[model samples]
Target: MSDRNDIDPFYDDRSDPVRVLVVDEAERGERLATGLEAETDRIAADTVPTVDAALEAVDRRPIECLVSTVHGPDGTGDELLAAIRDRYPAIPVVLVVPDEERAREAIDSGASDVVVAESVSERCFVLANRITTAADRYRADRRADRQRRRFREVTDAVPDCLWIVDPEWSELSFVSGYERIWDRTAAELTGTPEDFLNAVHPDDRERVRAAMDRLSDGTSVDLEYRIRRDDDLAWVRTRGEPIVDDGSVVRLVVLTRDVTDRKERERTLSALHSAAREIGSADEPAAVYETLIRTADRVLEFDYVAVDIKRDGYLVQEASTLDLKDGGYYERTSLENDDTFAVRSYKRQETILVDDLREFDVTPADPDYRSALTVPIGEFGTFQTGASEVGAFDRDDREFAELLVGHARVKLAQLQDKRVLRERTEQLERQNDRLDEFVRVVSHDLRNPVNVAKGHLSIAREQYDDDSLEATMEALERIETLIEDLLTLAREGEEIDDLEPVDLATLVPECWRYIDTKDAALEVETDRTIAADRNRLRQLLENLIGNAIEHGGSDVTITVGDLPEENGFYVADDGTGFANGEREKVFDPGYSTGVDGTGLGLDIVRRIADAHGWDVRATESDAGGARFEIVGVE
Candidate 1:
C-alpha cells in the first residue's frame, strides 16, 4: 500500500477517488481490487496480505474501508476486523469466508458484511459491491464529522450562546460558548425547561413562558427579556426554532445573546430624547414641571414627583404630581439637614438616592413608597422622584434620573432667563415711551416759559417797569424747575446698581428737608431698614412728599408707615384723597390736578420705584388720603 496520509481525505471532486484496503491472499486481493474498479469508477484499492499489513496501510493512508478473507496468510479475518474496530472504528470492514461456519463467525465478530465464496471469481462481484458501499458510507461520515467540528470552532468565537434541547425541554442536547460568555459551565445550565426558565428574571419569566407556549412545530421564535445570572441581571435576545419530526415537534434549537450593553444604550438614548422633547418646548415653569413629572413617570416609572423651591426663607411646594391638599410650606431653616432627602440634596448641591425609604432618617408620607431619588436644581430647588418598590432604582436609574434633572435645570434656566429678558425688554420699552413723553413735555413746557421770559424782558427793557421784570424772573424760575425735573427723570431711567441698608426714619426726615413740605405734618410710624440706593430713595421720598403738599393743602399730614406682612412701606396724606378712578392715572407723566404743579412728580416716583425693582401702586390710606405703597422691598 502507498502512504497517502499527507493527502486530504475530503477532496472536492471524484478525481481524488475513495481509498480502500484489500486484505487477503495475494491473488485474491489482486482480484478484489480489480473487481472493485469494475464495480465503481471512483474508488482506489490497495492490497495488503495480513492484518499487520492492513493496519500499517490504514495508518499510512486515508483508507475508507477494508476487504479481507476469513483466513489469511498472517491472521484470521476476524482478528483483522478486531484490530480495525479497535484502532479505526470509522473504517468499515468486509469479510469473505470459505464456509457457512466461518461466515457466521465473521458476522458475529462485527464485520460490515460476510460473503461465502465457493469460487473466487463468483465472489468478486459480491465483494466489489460490499467494498464500494462501505467506502461511500465512510466518506459521507467523515465529511459530516468535519462539518460538526467546523461549526463548533466558529460558534465558540462568537458572543451568541447556542443550544439544542429535546422537544419536552427535559434535557439540553448541546450547548456552545456558554462557559465563556455566561461565566458558567454548560453542565451547570443544562437541565429541564423549568430549570432554565427559573434563571430568567422573575418579572420577565412569565412573558418568556407565554412566548414559548405559543411556539409550534415548524415555527421560529424571537424575543428579548431579562435574565438573572448568579450575581447580576442581564438582558438577552433569544431566537429559537422547533425541530419537527413526523409532523410533530421533537426538539428546540435556541440562540441567546447577551445584549445588556446594547439595551442600556438604547434605553438611555430613548429617555434623553423623550425628556428633551418634553422640557425643551415648554413655555413656562409650570408647563416645564408638568412635562417633567409626566415624562418621569413614563420614562422612569416613578410613583410620584415633587419640586420644592425656597421662597421668603421657606420651602414651598412649587409643583407636585402627588395628590395632596396642603401642598403648603416647610420652614427652610428647619429642613436644612440630613433628616430630609430634599434638604440634604439642596444643601449639599448633589443628588441623593435612597433604595429603601423606611431606612431613611425622615418619615415617608406614603408607607408604601419604598425608594426615592432627589437632585438639586442648583440654588433654585429640589426635584424628587419616588418609587413603590424596594431596590427599584439602580445605578443606571440614578444616572438616567440625574441626566433628566440636568436637562430640566438647563431648560428651566433658559425659561427663567427668557422671562427676565422679556420683563426687562418691556420695562425698557415703557421707559422709552416715558422718555419720549418727557422730551415732548420739556419742549412744550420750556418753550412757553422761555417765550414768556423773552417777551417780558423785551417789555421790561422797553418800558422799564417792575411788574414785567418780576414776571420775567418768575418765568425763568419755572424754567429752572422744569429743567431740574427733566434731569431727575433722565437719571431715573437707569437701573440701581449699588445698594446699601438705609434707615427709613433717617431718610424720610432727610428727604423732608429737600422738599418744600410747608406746614405738612410728618409722621414716621415705623423705623425699618431696607436695602436701597440711598440717593434714589431720597428722591422718591421727596417727590411723594411734594405731591402730597401740592395736591393737598399746605397743612396736609404726610404719613410714612410700614406695609402689612413687612412687604414694604407706604406714603399717605390726611388731605383730600384721590378719586377712585383717578388714582391709577395720577402716576402718568404730565398729569397734575393742581394748576401750578408739574405733572412729572408722581411719574418720577414711579420711575424711581421701578429702577429699584419695587412695585408701586396707588390705594386708599387709613386717613382716606392718597397712598402710594412700594412692595417687594427685598
Candidate 2:
C-alpha cells in the first residue's frame, strides 16, 4: 500500500472530494479495490466487509456517496442502502451488483447509480465521476438553502416589500415580504411582471411603465406613485436597482414603501399657505369670501363654499361659490330657513364636521356633496365647505378650515370697522358744513346791526348823557369781538385736505404783520419748510402770536423757532408765564385770564394743529413766558 501522504497526480484539489464506503465480503472488497484506487484523485475509499461495519463507518464520519455489493456478509446491499437513506437521506448511493435482476432492484431501490459486475471493469471512471458530481451538487444545494433562510429573516423584519425581475421583464425572478404589505402571496404575484403595473393607480400606470422601459442599463429607479388594491389606496415610493454581472444587466431588484401620511401633510400645508396669502390681500369682506371659495376649490378640493353674515337674528348669505342668475334666491334665503346647516354651527358657536351630509337635517345645496365642514366666525357668521366624496374632510381638512375661517373673521371685522369710520367721517363733515354756514350767517347778520348801533350811540353822545352812550358803545364792541371769535372757531373746525410745503420763516413774519403786537418785538429763529395747509397754518400762527401779545407786555420779545430733532415748531414769549395749574386748561374755549380777552384763540390753534395730525403742548418758555410746542409735523 502507498503512504497516506501520496496524492494522485489526476486529482483536482480545488473540487470537493467524495468520501465513499464500500461494503462487501473481504474477497469482493479486495477485488474492487484496484478500480476504486485508480480514481483516488477525487474519491477517498473506506472498505467495510459487512453491513455493520458500513453503518459504523457512516456514523464515525460523514459519507458523501456509497458503493455496495449485491450481497454483503451481514445483509443484502439493498438493505444497507435502505439504512443510509433513512439515516442520511442526503447521501447518494451507487450499487455494484452481480446480475440484471439485482440491477433492476437497485434501480427501484433509489440508488444514485447502478453498475453491473461485468461492466464495472470498463466503466470505473464514469462511475467515479457520477459520485463526485452528486457530492458537488449536494453541497451547492446546502449553501443555497442557508442563504434563503437568512434572506427570509432579514426581509421579514422590515416594512418594505422586496422583489426581483429579470431584465426581459417576462416574469418575476424573486419576491419576498410582499405578502405582508399587499396581503398577497408570492405565488399569486410571481408569474406576470405586469402584476406590479396593474396594481398602480391609473394615473401613475404610464409613469411606472416608462420607468421600466429605462431599466435596460444597470441604473437605479426611484419613483413615487399611487397604488390601489381592491378598495384600498395608498401612496407608494418604489426604488429599483439593477444587479449587474460582468457589465451586463442580470436582474432588477425593487423596494416599495407606503408614504401616504407624508404626502397628505405636505399637500395640506401647501393649501393653507396659498389660502392665507390670497385671503389676507383681499380688500373687502366680499372679496375675502370670493378668494376663499376659489382657493378652497383649487387646493382643498372642496366643491362648494358659502359665507353667511348674521343680521337681525338671521344669517344672510353674503358670498358663495355658486353663481346665481337672479342673485335674489341666495339673498332671500336666510339661515332661519329649514334647509341651511350654517345656522346650526352659528347657534352652537362651534365647528361641524360631517362625513355624510345625509346625517344633517338640512339638504345640501348640491346633492352630490357628501362631506361638509362648517366653522363659525364668532357672532358674525359661518364659513362652510362641501366635498363630493364622503369622508373627504379629515382631521387635516378640519384644522385648515378653522385656520382659514379665523383669519377671514379678522379681515371681515377690519372691513366693517373701516366702512363705519368712513360713514361717520362723512356725517361729521356734513355737520361741520352746517355749523360753518350758521356761523357765517350769524356773523354777517348780527355784526352789521351792532356796528350801526355803535354809530347811532356816537351820534347820540352829543345829545344825551355821556356815561350812558359810552356804556352802550362798550357793549357793542364786546359783541363784535365775540362774533369774530365765533366765526374763526367755526371755520377752523373744517377738515384740512390739501397741504403744501410752507416755510415757517415766511409764515411767522406774515402772521406777525396781522397781529397787534403793540410794542412786542418779533424774533424769527427757524427756516424749516414743513408740509402743511398754508391757510390753516397761518391761522395757527396768528392765534399763538396774538395770545402772546395779549399776555406779554408791549416790549416782550416773541420768539418763533424750530424744535430740536425736527419735532415741530415752538412759539414762546418773554413775559410772565402761566401760574401753576393753568397749562392743561389754557386751550379751553371761553376760559380766559384777561377780562378783555376772548379765549377762543388758543382753542382754534389746537383745532388747526389736530387737523394737520400734529400734537400741541403748553409749557414754560426760556424767557419765563408761555410756550406752545407743536410736534408730529410732516
Candidate 3:
C-alpha cells in the first residue's frame, strides 16, 4: 500500500491537544468537562460559566477549539460562533447541543459543526475529523482548479456533448452517450434534440424547454424532467451549456442522464428513515413493531409478516399481521408446529420461510403451513439461513425467512434497547459489533479486487512498455483508487469538527499538485476562502478537476472565483460540463461519464461537503467545461 503519510495530509499533526472552552453553569460545566477529559486524553477542556469568560479565555490563550453548550448561563453557542468567526477565525469551534434545534442554530450562526450531547463521543469525534478533512480538501480543490484553467481548448471542446440547436430548435451536434441513452442515432436528432424531446412529459417539458432555451440564450441552467418514452415516463436530468457570440444564446449544449434508480432509492430511504425515527420514539414496543411491519409491507413490497418472541422454548407471538390476512389467519397457525417455521427459527436461531407449507402435515395436531416468515427476537440476534432452507429469492419454499430475518436483526437491535438498562448496554455492544463487522466486510470485499487489479496492473505495466498497455494500467489504477474510496466512506465516523476559517484560494492550488497530470495541461487561479474542511475541500477539487481532464478532454483549464449571492468558491473547467440526463445521476455511486472511472470521486466530493455543512454541485462553467461550485463557502 502506498503510504499516505508521504502525501502530507496538510495537517502536520492532529494529535495536539484540543484546547476547548466548556461553558455551562458551575456544576454541569465542570462535570461535563470532566467527562470530556476522560473521554479523550487529547482533549483539554477548561470549564467556564459564561460566554464572556469563554471569550476571555480564548483571548488569553491561543484556544485551538471550543466545545460548549448551546445555551449556557450567560449566552448561547451561536454567540460564541459569531464571536469566533469575526474575531478568532483560526480556532475551530463545535457546539454540544442537546437536540436538533440547537444543532440547527449552530449551523445557521456559522459554528464549525455541532453534535448532540447524547452522542458526544461517537458524533463529536467524527465531526472533528471531518472538519479537518474538509479544510484540507477545500484548499486542494482551489489549487487544482487553478492548475486546470491553463490548458488548451481541444481537451475542453472534444469531450463536450456539443449540442447545437438553431432558433427553431433543430439539433446540429451531439456527442458522448447520446445514441445509447436515447436508443436513437445522434444523426437522427441533428438540430432537433429538443424536438425529439416531444417524448418529454407535459408537466416537465415547459421547464425543460425553458431551461434549454435559457442555455441557448447564453444563460446556463440545470434541470430535471420526466421524458415520456414508449408508454411510460422516464426521469431525465440535464445541465445546459450555451454557446454565445454576444449576449444572445445561438446554440444549446446540454448533458443528460437517467436518474430513475437514484431518485427512487433516495425517496425510499427518506421514507424508511422517517418511519424508523417516528416508530423509535413510540412509547410502546408493540407500536414500534407495528410501525415496522406496516412500513416494511407497504414500502418494500413484502407479502407476509409475523413477529414472535421466544422465552423458555415457548412462542410469544407479539405481532402477527399477514399481508394476505383475513379473519381466519390464526386458525392456520402451523408456526408453532413441532416441525414448523417458529420451531426452526427458535431451535436454530435463524429465520424460516415456507413458501408452500401446504406440503407439510396440517393434520391439526401436525399443523400444516406454507409461505411464512418467523424471526428471532434478541439483541444478539443473527438471522442465519437455515440449512433446511429452500431457494433464495424464489417462489419456492425459499429463504424468504432470511429476508425478514435480515430486517429483523436490525429491528431486534432496536427492540433490545427497550428491555432494561443492563440489556440496553448489551444491545449497544451487539449493535457496535454488527456495525464493525459491516465496516470490515465492506472494506475487505471492496478492497480485494481493487488491490489485486492495481497490483497486477503495476506488474503488467512493468512487463509491457506499450502506450495502450500503459493507458490500460492507468485506468486500472484509477479504478483501484475509486474502490479504496468506498472503504474510506464506510470508515468515516460521525462527529462535528471545530469550525475554522479556511482560505480556499491558497489551499485549492496546493492539492492540485498531488495528481500526476504532468502530461495533461494545467492552469489554476482563485482568490476565495471559506469555512470548510481543509482535506475535503481538496478532494472536491481533485474529483472535479480529475473529471474535467478525463471527460472534458486530456487538456483543460480551471478557474476559481467567488459567487455573489452566496460567499462561495467556483471551480470551472472547459470540459464536458454535464451531459443531458446526467447532471444528478453523475453523483450516484458507480455512475460515471467516462468509461474508465469507478464513479466515486464526485460522490466523495459531495458527501464530504455534506458532512462539513456545505454544498458542492455541478453547473455550466465560464470555460465551457463542467463547473463545480462549493456553495455557502463561508
Candidate 4:
C-alpha cells in the first residue's frame, strides 16, 4: 500500500494503462500476467510468486488492481484479500477461484470481482474487463473526493456566505461562512433550512421569504436586506440563482455578502451632500460653523461635536452639541497651545484621530472624552468630535468629519472675502467724503484772498501800465486755474451717479470750442453715442484737446475716433508723442512734462474712466502721436 501523502490528488490515471499485480505460484502467475496483458492494451500485469511478494510489489509501486489465485505459495488468496483491504482499501481486488462456492466466499470477503479458474484460459477478455473497470472506478472516486475538498477550501476562504438547498427547501446540501456571517451554527440551519430566516430583521423577513420563493420558481433574485444578530443589525446583499435540470428547478444557489459598511457610507455621503448645500448658502461664518457641528452630530453620531474659529490668535469655540454646551466644555485655547487637540490639528493642518486620549500626553478640551477626532477647517479653525467611550471613532468617522469641515472651510473663505470687500468699500467712502470737504475748504479759503489780490492788481494796473503788473495778473490767473482743476478732480471723479446717452459727435465739438486752441485742427471722426455723465465727458474731451494743443504746437491735428474693436473710443494727436518710459506715468496725479502744466488733466481722465468701469492706457498712435484709448464701455 502507498502512503497517502505520495498520491497526487489532482492526477488523472484513467488515460494511462492500469498496472495489475498477479499473485500465485510462479508458472500460474506468469501465465495469468501474460494472458491479462494479451487481452488488452489498457492492462499491464506484473507476476508475483507469493502473497508476501505481491504485498511488497503493491507497496513499491502504484498498483490500481490486484489479481490473485485461490492458493498461493505463502498464503491463501483470502488472506491476501484481507491484508489488502486493511491497508489499501482504495485498491480493488479480484479473486480467481475454482467454483461458485469459492466465488461466493471471495465476494463475502470483499473481493471486487471473482473469476473461475476453469474458464481462465478462454475467458481472458472477461477478466481484462473486470480489472480495467475496477481500476477506472477507483480513480474516479479519488478525483471526486479531491474536488470536494478543493471546493470546501475555496468556499471557506471567501467572505461571502455560500449556501445551496433543494427546490422544496427541505435540506441544506451545502453551507459555508454561515456561522461567522449570520452569528449562528450550520447545524441549526441543516435540519430546518428555513430556520436561517429567523435571524433576518423582522421588517425584512417577508422580503427574504419572497426572494426564496422566486428562486424556487426558477427566477433569479438579487436583494439587499437587513439581518439581526442579538442587538445589532447588518445589511446584506443576497443574490440567488435557481439550478435548473431539464427545465425544472432542482436547487437554489445563494451568495450573500455583508454590506453594512457600504450602506452606512452611502447614508453618510447623502447627508453630507445635503449639509454642503446648506453650508454653502450661509452668509455668515457663525452659521457655517453651526451647520458643520450639526452635520457631525447627525452623521458621525459622536457624543460631542464642536466648532472652533480662529479669532485674535485664539481658537474660540463657537458652536457645540447640546451635551458639550451643557457640560461647559466650550474651550478657548491660544494658537500656540500644542497640548490641545483642536489647536494641534489646526497648526498641523491635518486631521488628528486619537483612539484613546489617555494614551496620549496631550490634553483634550473635554477631559471626559476618552476618544477624539479633530479635523482642521483649512486655515479658518478646527472641527472636533469626541466620545466618552474609548476607540469609538473609526476611519470612516474621520473621513466624514473631514468632508463636513471641508465644506465649512470654503464657506468661511467666501464670507471672509465678502467682509473684506465691504470694509474696503466703507473705508473708501469715508476717504472720499474727507477729500470733498478738503476741496471745498481750500476752494473757499484760497479764493477769497485771490479775489482781493485781483482787485488790488486791477487798481495797480489802472495806476501804472507795466510788464510787472501784467505778469502779476497772469500768475494770479494760473493759481485760480489750478484751484479750479483741483475742485473738478475732487467733485466729479469719484463715481458716476447718473448716466445718459451723450453723442460723441456733438460733445466733441462742444469741448473743442471750450478749449483755447489757437490753430489745432479738430476732426470728430465718430458718430457713436455712449452712456456717460455728459459734464464729465466734456471735461475729459477738453483735457485731451488742450493737452494736444499745448504739447503738439498750435497747428497740431487732433483726431477723435471710435475704437470699434476695443468697444470704446480713442483721442489721438499728431504731436510729439510721450517720451520713453513716460506712458505708464502719464496718468499719475501731479505728473507733467510741460513747464506750466497743472498735471491733473490726464489723472482726472483716468479717474472718470475707472468710475465708468473702463480701462484707459497711453500708447503711440499710428500717426506718430500720443493716443489715449479707453475700452470696456457698456
Candidate 4 similarity to native, TM-score: 0.81
Tens digit per residue, CA lDDT, model 1, 1-634:
2233224434432345667778887887898788877776777888987789988877876677788776535555777989988998767888878889888877777887878986657877777777777767766666676667777877988878998887666778778977654667777764666766877889989988876765634568899999877798889998888888888888888888999988877977786887778789888777776766766776676777777776654456777776565432232333543257787788799998898988866776667788888888776788888888988888877787778778888988998899999999999899889888877777676667677777767767687757757766776777767777877888797898899999999999988887777888999997899999999899899989988898878999999999868589999998889976898798899888887667888889999999988989988888888888999897
- Misplaced by over 4 Å in model 2 are 1-160, 176-183, 200-211, 216-227, 232-248, 255-374, 382-394, 439-480, 490-510, 519-535, 552-557, 574-576, 622-624, 632-634
Task: Estimate every model's Cα lDDT from 0 to 1.
Answer: 0.79, 0.79, 0.60, 0.86
Off by over 4 Å in 4: 1-15, 48-61, 322-330, 356-359, 365-370, 387-392, 425-513, 521-541, 555-584, 593-596, 611-634
Report the C-alpha displacement of residue 503, candidate 4, in angstroms: 10
lDDT score, candidate 4, position 434: 89
Q: In candidate 4, how many Å is residue 498 off? A: 11
**Candidate 2 residue lDDT tens string, 464-491:** 8778778778778888888888888887
* Per-model TM values vs. the true structure: 0.50, 0.61, 0.32, 0.81
Question: Residue 98 of model 4: what lDDT?
Answer: 79
- Candidate 1: TM-score? 0.50
Writing each residue's lDDT as its tens digit, candidate 3 over 298-329 gives: 54444444455554445544555543245323
Q: On residues 1-634, what C-alpha lDDT tens digit does candidate 4 reach at each position?
A: 4434236666766678888998777888888899999989999898887777878888898888999878434546888899999888889998878789989999999999988867567678888998998988987876787778888888999998999988888788888998778988887764554586888888989988988888899999999999987789999999999999999998889899999989998999999999999998998887888788878888888788888888899988888885544663656888875468788888889999999999988766568889989999888888888888999998888888888888888888889899999999999989988897888777998888999999999999999989999999999998998998899888656778899999999999888877888988988899999999888888888888888888888999999999899899999999989898999899999998988789998998988888888998999988899998989876
For model 1, state the Cα shift of residue 350 in Å. 20
Model 3 lDDT-worst window of ten: 381-390
- Descending-TM-score candidate ranking: 4, 2, 1, 3
Give candidate 3's TM-score: 0.32
Number of clashes in model 4?
A: 0
Task: Please identify model 3 stretches exceeding 4 Å from their true place.
Answer: 1-167, 179-196, 229-233, 246-248, 305-634
